[model samples]
Target: MNKLLEGKRLLITGAARGLGLDFARRACAAGARVVMADILDELVTEEARALAEQGHDATAVRLDLADPDAIDAVAKFAGETLGAVDGLVNCGAIATGIGGPDMCELELDTWDRVATVNVRGTWLMSRAMVPYLAASGRGRIVNIASDTALWGAPRLMAYVASKGAVISMSRSMARELGPKNICVNTLCPGLTLCEATEYVPQDRHDLYVNGRAIAREQVPEDVTGSVLYLLSDLAGFVTGQTLPVNGGFVFN
Candidate 1:
């Protein structure tokens, strides 16, 4: 009932389902107008419509992170449509399935694709929105990384590498945009039990859960509170830091 994000306009990428959709829901609940962007157009449209039906100001945009032009276009569209975007949550990335072969057996295309979408896409989308966010005066960028990045997981080399890049980029972007009043930070969540992560091996799931300090399954909801805090005014002074939403599995 506090409406932490009141008067804010935010855009979320990869919002078709999973954590991104959860983020959209939480943002709307926090009193922010949300523009959900994802490559899955129809699904994201339904997501946006559902939020609207609930009396929340929400819209959906079809965005492909692989396309530089599409990334820029979507950021522009968000600003024009929402009047101004106060924040952006970079959650879009290629869902490289879990338990792939080791790096030696990993295909070149697989590695490249993950890096392109996860690392480059995050950089470009943040770049495209810089001007508009700066204009908002209290602009915020929350880049979604992974706990895998914090603690290197052997089987997911590409994903771990890509997420590591996201965390590094967040720090650099924070310094670059800080003068303009834009804050950039990275969120590293553990192996959350979401639709996309259902394919993860049970042992891998247990590895995260059992290793966590709290020893419980992580969920989308578990990650939302930190995300909301990062996007709200409470985190205005926070930037260039890696905040883990995992159950104390990894530290800063």
Candidate 2:
């Protein structure tokens, strides 16, 4: 709405639904040409088509972060399509159905799976985009993390560890990418109400709601503003930092 990202080229992952898709739409509305990548190819294509019908510059690409080849392909496709990726939102990860076991009960395969998708995927994607971002001369990277790591949420060992890795990686990335004028930051949201979170137990949801100072459920929209700001020039000087967008449920 503010045209904050006018003429910027953006690549957003996990954009078939939830927070990633919202960020893509918001970025488009803010005057950025976006390439939305997701593992759900057909669904993402449809979403991009809908955005196109509304006169927004949007393209959808298939991205399966589990496969290194897929990640490379998507990044190449986005760079070619966007013509110079000014920003990237690494919002894709294994979030659903990966928790519920305590760390002691968590299987090594499960832990490896979460790390491969969430941690490795974020790192590879960011590496693939460095060239284009450096070319933009003011690139931004917003890695979507979770507040569960900060609060030490129980029975979610793998998810929490993966997000913790993301938070740590962002800071390192900011320092490394800073020389290229690329800002890298992390956004840690609390248990947000999204399709991916529908499997969360009612008791857990209640705990988050009651614990937040805001005393309300967090929706996908609640986080889009902070995400967009990080991708915009307004946050050019803001990097190597983590902001908890969880309504005071856990202050960072």
Candidate 3:
């Protein structure tokens, strides 16, 4: 209800559906201009159009996180179209059709794919957009990570490794960019019920949710508040940290 992000330009990845889409909607509701980019161009465009019809400042673009050129082009377009971006939410990721390889049975191509999109994609996107964010004078980067990485889940070895890399990279970026007034942090969510989690085996899902302290399943919206906080001015001093939205699934 509060326009906490008024006039801020935010570029969110994987915003066609799920948590990314939820973040875009909430950010716009809070008075921020939003650019929703996803690999699913049609869905993202439709979403953006719907939001625009509701009088929100929103736009959509096709972005493949696994591709370097696509990341570059989208960053450029976002800068030119939305002006200087104040926030970047790295929510774009491949999980269902991409991860779950056992470490011993993992293929090189699979490892590469996960690393490229999850790790490299986050890097490329941040690198490409740093200039615009710097221009804003109060840039914020919220990277979507996973609790699996912190607790060391099995069978999803590659994904865990990639997310571990994400957490590490966020800390390093935060330190390096601190002088520029940019805050970089990781938003680690527990096993959430989304299209991406459908690929996770039922047993694995149970392991994540059944024993959780909250006694409830995690949803996209459950993590939105933490994201909004990290991207808001309130979190100006909260950099190089991992904020877990895991319902006590994994304590710090």
Estimate every model's Cα lDDT from 0 to 1.
Answer: 0.92, 0.92, 0.90
Error of 1 at 53 (Å): 0.5
lDDT (10s digit) by residue, model 1, range 1-252: 359999799999999999999999989998999999999999999999999999999999999999999999999999898876799999998757778889899889999999999999999999999888988999999999998988899878999999999999899999999999999999999999888897899989888888889999998999998999999989999999999989989977
Query: By TM-score, is 1 or 3 better?
Result: 1
Give candidate 2's TM-score: 0.98
RMSD of each: 0.9, 1.1, 1.5
Q: Best TM-score goes to which candidate? A: 1
Please give each candidate's TM-score: 0.98, 0.98, 0.96
> How many backbone collisions does model 3 have?
0
Ranking by TM-score: 1, 2, 3
Q: Write the per-residue lDDT of candidate 2 for residues 1-252, one digit (tens) a residue.
A: 479889999999999998888899999999999999999999999999999999999999999998999988988998889877899999999863534777778889988998999999999999999998998899999999999989888888888989999999999999999999999999999888887888889899899999999999999989999998998878889999999999999987
Model with the higher TM-score, candidate 2 or 3: 2
Model 3, range 49-121, lDDT digits (tens) per residue? 9999999999999999988999999999999998888999999987633245567888888789989999999
